[model samples]
Target: MAESTAPPVRITSFGYGHCRGGLRIPRAHLVLDLRTHFRDPHVAPELRHMTARDQEVRDAVLSTPGISELVEATAAAVRAYQAGPTTELVTVAVGCTGGRHRAPTVALAVARALRLAHDWQAVTVIDRDIERSVIAR
Candidate 1:
C-alpha cells in the first residue's frame, strides 16, 4: 500500500483594483479593505485617538461593528473554502488610502487570523503597487 499526499493550499494578497483572472482552477479569493470600514469619521472616539501602530488598532479593527461584520463575512468565505474538496488557493485584497500602512497591516492581520483560525497553508502578502514598481521597466 502507498500513502498519498494532498495538494498544496495557498493564500494570497492583492491591492485595490488589482485582478487575478488568469490563474488556474482550485483557487479561492478573499478581498478586504481597511479604508472601506475605517475611513469614516464616525469610528469610535477611543479608536480615533489611538495611533496606527498601537495594538488598540488591531483590537478596534476587529471590534468595529462594520469591520467585524466584514471579518465574519471573510471567515465564512474561508470556511466554505475549507469545507470544499479541492486543491485550493485564495487571494485576498486589502485596500487603504496608501499601500504603505493600514492596508498591508490589516492584510497581514487577516492572513494571520485565517491561518490560526482555519489552519490554512501558505499565506502570501503582496503589496501590489510595490510589485508593480519593481517590475516596471
Candidate 2:
C-alpha cells in the first residue's frame, strides 16, 4: 500500500500535574483529557508504578469501557484535520492525571489506529511525562 501523503502528525502524552508551576502542555490541534472519563491505573497497587510501556498498564487502559471507541474517534479527527486544506503538521495531545497509564496508552493506540487506517508514514508518538515521578493525588 502506498504511504499516505498527508502532513505529518505528532501525538504527545502528558500529565496534568506537569502543567503546574507555569509549565505548559504541548500545543495540539486536538487534546483528549483522559483524567475523568477514563480509569486511572495509578490507583491500582499492582499497576501503580508501571508506565504505558508495560503491557499490564497498556491492557488496563485499553480495556477501559470507552477507550477503544475514543481511540477510533481521535484517529478520525486526525484524518479530518489532514483532509483539510493545510500542509502544517497535526499535533494531538493526550493527557491523563499522571501520564503513566491512560494517556500514553491512548496516544500509542491513536498512532496505531492512524497508521492502519490511513497508512500514515510520519506519525510520531511521544510520552512526555511517562518517565517523570508519579504525581501524588
Candidate 3:
C-alpha cells in the first residue's frame, strides 16, 4: 500500500449572522461583513430591515475602519499561502443581515477578485445557512 498525497482543501465560507458559531473548519478562515462596504447613509434599505440583533452585528462590522485594507489583506494572504510549500485552501466568510442579498454579493465579489488576482486551483463561496438547508439537508 502507498500513501497518496492530496491537495490541501481550502473551504471558504460566506454567510450571515446566523452562521457565526457554526463555522469550524481546519483551514484558513476569514470572516467579513458586507455592510462594511456601505457608508452609513448609503446602506441599502433591504439591509436596514434586519432584526435588531442582526443590525447590531452589522453595526459592529461597519464600525471597523479601512475595510478595503481588510479585503486586500485577505487576497494577499491567499497569494502568500499559495506561494508556500503546502497546497493551500482559503476560506473567506462574508456576512450581512441575511444570506439573500449583501452576503452573496460580497461573496461573489471576493471570489471574482481572488480569481482575477490569484491563480488559485479552486475557489468556492459557501452561504452556510442557505447552503446547509438547500444542499446539505
Candidate 4:
C-alpha cells in the first residue's frame, strides 16, 4: 500500500489561565498539562514577555530536566495512535500556565522529534495563546 501523505497529527499549545469566559482548550486525543510538572518561564522578567518563538525562551524551556523526555513520550503516544486500525488525525493538546512559554516550546519540540524520527512528513503545531497578553501570576 502506498503511504499516505496527509499530515496525521496536530499539536496545540494553550494557557489554562486564558480559558476564562469562552476560550476553551482544544479537543485532542492526548492532553498533557505542564502547569505543575514544568517550570514557567513567565517567572523570569526577561522571559515573561517573550513567546516560544524566541530562541532564549525556547532554550530555557527545553533545558528543564524532564522536558525532553516528555516530548519523546508524547511522540511515542502519537505513534501508538497512528498504529490503530482506523486512519485518523491525531491531536495533542499541551497546556501550561500562560501558554507563551513552556507549552508552545514543548509542542514545537515534540513536532521536531517526530519529524526527526521519520514518524511523519508533516506535523502541525498551533500556539493557541502565544500572542495573548502575559498572565500575571
Q: What is the lDDT of every predicted structure here?
A: 0.49, 0.92, 0.48, 0.89
The model with the greatest lDDT is: 2
Candidate 2 yields a Cα-based lDDT of 0.92
- Per-residue lDDT tens digits for candidate 1, residues 33-118, read 56565642214466443433467655555555666556557756766665668755545566554343455546666566666665
Clash statistics: count for each candidate: 3, 0, 2, 0
Ten-residue segment with the worst summed lDDT in candidate 1? 128-137
Which candidate gets the maximum TM-score versus the true structure? 2
Model 2 Cα shift for residue 62 (angstroms): 0.4
Residues 42-134 of candidate 3 have per-residue lDDT tens digits of 244554434222545345333446545665676676566556677545456655544544455445545666666644436666555433332
* Residue 1 displacement in candidate 2 (angstroms): 3.7
Residue-level lDDT of model 2, residues 64-132, one tens digit each, is 999999999999999999999998999999999888899999999999998888766699999989999
TM-score against truth, every candidate: 0.52, 0.96, 0.51, 0.93
- Pairs with steric clashes in candidate 2: none
Candidate 4, residue 90: lDDT? 88
After best superposition, candidate 2 residue 18: deviation in angstroms?
A: 1.1
For candidate 4, which ten residues in a row score worst on lDDT? 1-10
Candidate 3 contains a number of clashing pairs equal to 2
| Model 3 stretches astray by more than 4 angstroms | 1-16, 20-28, 34-69, 119-121, 130-137
